[model samples]
Target: MPPVWDPAEAPVGDVGAALLMVDARIKEIHEPEDESEDGAEAERGELNRLFVASAGAEGVQELLDGTCTLLYMFMQWLRRTHEHGDKDVIEYVVPPLVATLRMMPRSVRPQTVPTMVALVVAAGTQVSPNGWRSQYGDWTPEEMNALEATVFLVAEHINRIAGDHNFAVRMIAETLTRVETDGD
Candidate 1:
């Protein structure tokens, strides 16, 4: 027998209902107790059914919309965290940040560069030896350097995106000028 659906597994919030529905379908198709050979075959059949069902679900559209919104918010958070000199947050968020930067569409690339540059500048400006200690704990200098490399990669991505938009180039230039003048 397939597992019963449970709405509780759905993430609560903007995309919660859709995620929950997907989770319920996944659970129904792959119950923990269904370990037998026959169960495996049944699981495959259930998976196919789930694919078809999900393809037609309004939930999937909601999920996609939610994901895009979350991604934008996450980028904003990263920018703020960097501005606050929160190395701990950067250390924890780097991997996902890099992944998001890499996967974002070219259309959004220009808008994303400033945040990425801000994150790198923030990471480089860490003044407290213990600031990153809580999160990275025992990370070697090499590990920290690797994180810097990721920041550099994001910077390059920003540059690539800026090349595609004249407005982005002007905006970035103006922002850089403001930062430079404000520092004086």
Candidate 2:
């Protein structure tokens, strides 16, 4: 994989705008195999649907690759934002990844784990040494607990949507290791 794009060097000014740019780039690279679906549906599902109509490992690889690109883009967009400040972005990012984990057969599970790791690493970088504190850094214990509950709202999301038991266990273990090790 290419070196992770550094947000400071090329900050993504607006998340949606960057994604639209990526959409165009993806189109430039990948011609859709199926044109039966209308442009609107195809446009929105471009990232996740790459594999459904194509044949062989190349198709599945493209689907996972698209998702990983999305993950990288979201993380770059999240740079320097306070914890949970990127909540909206996370909501947009995690579901597709979770769905990919559950919906794709185990054939891609090994490859997909790296994509999950990228998310964990991105979220980890968003925090301060003080840890997810508000701008003022004066949050109370209760407030801190509440924030912690939601700090990893994405993690909680995956936990609830564990459609594949073994895959889910591996993901849970990876997330725990990243959290415990301060994202290395």
Candidate 3:
């Protein structure tokens, strides 16, 4: 199921109702026709692969801040380079990844949403970086440690595939020029 994330698009009338709508999206994504445990597990594995973004996002500290800045910056980059692609790529990986965001404390959920959206989008395309906004409060050290990556596994993946050694490094300029700094 596709993730319905934008609260503005919610049909509800109040903030509380909108929160319900937002939370409901997590439930909705997990409700596939097959309710077996195996089905759910498959969804989770796929979701993990999606967030990895070929970025080896498993223990790099550069993107960590009071909030998940890696996620925020990546999403900002996606909006500029692949808005429609974001829509296309996100649906397939919604279950656990969306669930992950839903699992976060409500205090920081709003701040981390773009990171979720960005990861969902970055799953398919080679969408990448540019951006400046990041939140600096309302985060736990454990949470920050849980999610951070400094290596671009995809850059190597693409380079190896394309046989263009310089292709990955060249992307930095393209991404920077197109992406905007978010969360200022």
TM-scores, all candidates, are 0.26, 0.26, 0.27
CA RMSD (A), model 3: 16.6
By the TM-score metric, which is better: model 2 or model 3? Answer: 3
What is the overall TM-score of model 3 with all chains considered together?
0.27
Give per-residue CA lDDT, model 1, range 26-51, as digits (tens): 34434555455566656755864685
Q: What is the Cα-based lDDT of residue 60 in candidate 3?
A: 23
Return the TM-score for candidate 1, rounded to 2 decimals: 0.26
lDDT by residue for model 3 over 1-184, one digit each (tens)? 1222332221221222222222233234444455555666567557545644653433222222212222323334434444555553244334434555556554234455565455335433333211221223333433332232211222333334447644433454344445535423
The 10-residue segment with the lowest total lDDT in model 3: 7-16
Please, what's the RMSD in Å of model 2? Answer: 18.0
lDDT of 2 by residue, 117-177 (tens): 3444554454221211122344343332222222233333333444432332244345446
As for candidate 1, its clashing pairs are 10-20
Order the candidate numbers by lDDT, best to worst.
Answer: 1, 2, 3
Q: Lowest-lDDT window of 10 residues in candidate 2? A: 127-136
